[model samples]
Target: MELIFLGTGAGIPSPERNVTAVALALNEERGTFWLFDCGEATQHQIMRSPLKLSRLEYIFITHLHGDHIYGLPGLLSSRSYHGGTTPLTIFGPAGLARFIETSLQVSGSHLDYELRIEELQEGVIFEDEQFTISCARLEHRIDSYGYRIVEHDLPGRLDRDRLIADGILPGPIYQQIKLSKEPIAYEGRLLDPKRYVGPDIPGRKLAILGDTRPAPNALQLAQTVDVLVHEATFAEAEAELARRYYHTTTRQAAEIAAQAGAGELILTHFSSRYNREDLAWLIQEASRYHKPVYAAYDGYQHPIPRK
Candidate 1:
């Protein structure tokens, strides 16, 4: 999996940055891409990146803020024209459905595919064979939430040497051993499936937070995450302003990362005032407490390696 930042600026699009939009590309794992937020002109930003809109399967919005959902109508309408017949699902807080419906109706946009929406609350947001998504509300101006994506424990890999030593050549049987429950019988004895398994491999985890101040729930949700994507709308010196606006600063974000013991901290949703050079200062301030703090910019893709 990899995270591609289509737009990392906050509130408005800048010459150097766009609004907030993040894409988690899992094409190799599931041939699908999941989006975190769709800021204004998100589709236009996606056009310049290596990501494919056709592969988008899920859109998770953290809140109903205008900067987050402004691009939904255009993206959905364009999806139909781009041959996106596959079903799509969107999960977010209440009023999300109303916003989409009103926007589509007023803009005369129609999609030729299945569109599903889920108004969510604090709990398990999503789950599958490989991952489980956890969410909790954050302290923001309005109702908002933070999301945690915890990957499930993966089964052990097949021991090819053990199979070959047992006179089992490479064929459909090996494929079955790697993927399913259909076991093969060898020399009148049924070989157990577990014998051909190697060591178990653990999966990685990621956390995505919306516009909010530092809260205990946010810290708990991001605990030990492989990658923690938090918002740094201001620097350390702007703590008063940040709290007054119900947002977080660089230092507060770093403290959250340190408190949660996250392996890596990625700070996005920057204020429009700071330039790319100022972004480095934000990272440095964050790194004082947490190592490897990444400041995101438009079109910057950070690969999440399978460990």
Candidate 2:
């Protein structure tokens, strides 16, 4: 899996950074991509990147803030014109449906594919064979949320030596033994699948938070995650202003990542006042507390490390 940052600025678009939009590309895992936020001009950002709209299968809105969701209607409408006929699902807070519906209806936009909008609360929102998504409330100006995307543990590789020693050759029966849950009778002996299987490979976990102050749920959502994407809307000097605006500072975001024991931290949702040149200070401040901290910019692509 890979993370592609479309826009990383907060509140408004700047020349260096646009707004808040992230794409978790799962092309190798599931042949689809999941978007975290769709800020204004998000589609335009996608055009400038290697991301494909047709591969977008899900959109998770962190809140109803205009900067976090203004481009939803346009992206959804344009998906039809592209090669996006497959079903798409969106998860967000309450009133998200009204916003999308009103925007589409007012502009006479129609989609040719199935669209599902699920209002999120503080709980497990989605789960499938591959992934599980959960949300927790955050302390923001509005009802913002942080999402935890946990990938399911994949089955371990088959032990060919064990199979060969047990008189099992590399044939159709090997595939059956690997997939079957019950014991298989091979040469008058019951071969247990568990005995020949190796350990399960742990999956990667990612936590993406919206605009918020440091809260208990933030740590809960990001506990020991592979990547923690948190908002750092202000520098260390602007702690008072950040708290007053119900946002997080660089130090506060770094503390969250350090406390949660996240593998890596990517600080995003920067204030427009700070330009690209100011990112080194933010990254340095965060790195003091957390190793491998990154201040995200538009079109930044990060490859998730496989442990």
Clashing pairs in 1: none
Question: Taking the tens digit of each residue's C-alpha lDDT, what string does model 2 give over 1-307?
Answer: 9999999999989778898999999978999899999999999998898888888999999999999999999999989887899999999999999999888899999899999999987899999999999999999999999999999887667899988997788888787777777898887889888877776779999999999999999999999999999999999889999999999999999999999999889999999889989999889988888888998899899998656
lDDT of 1 by residue, 255-291 (tens): 9999998988999999999999887788999999898
Evaluated at residue 149, the lDDT of candidate 1 is: 92
Report how far off residue 212 is in candidate 1 (Å).
Answer: 0.8
RMSD of 2: 1.3
lDDT of all the models against the reference? 0.89, 0.92
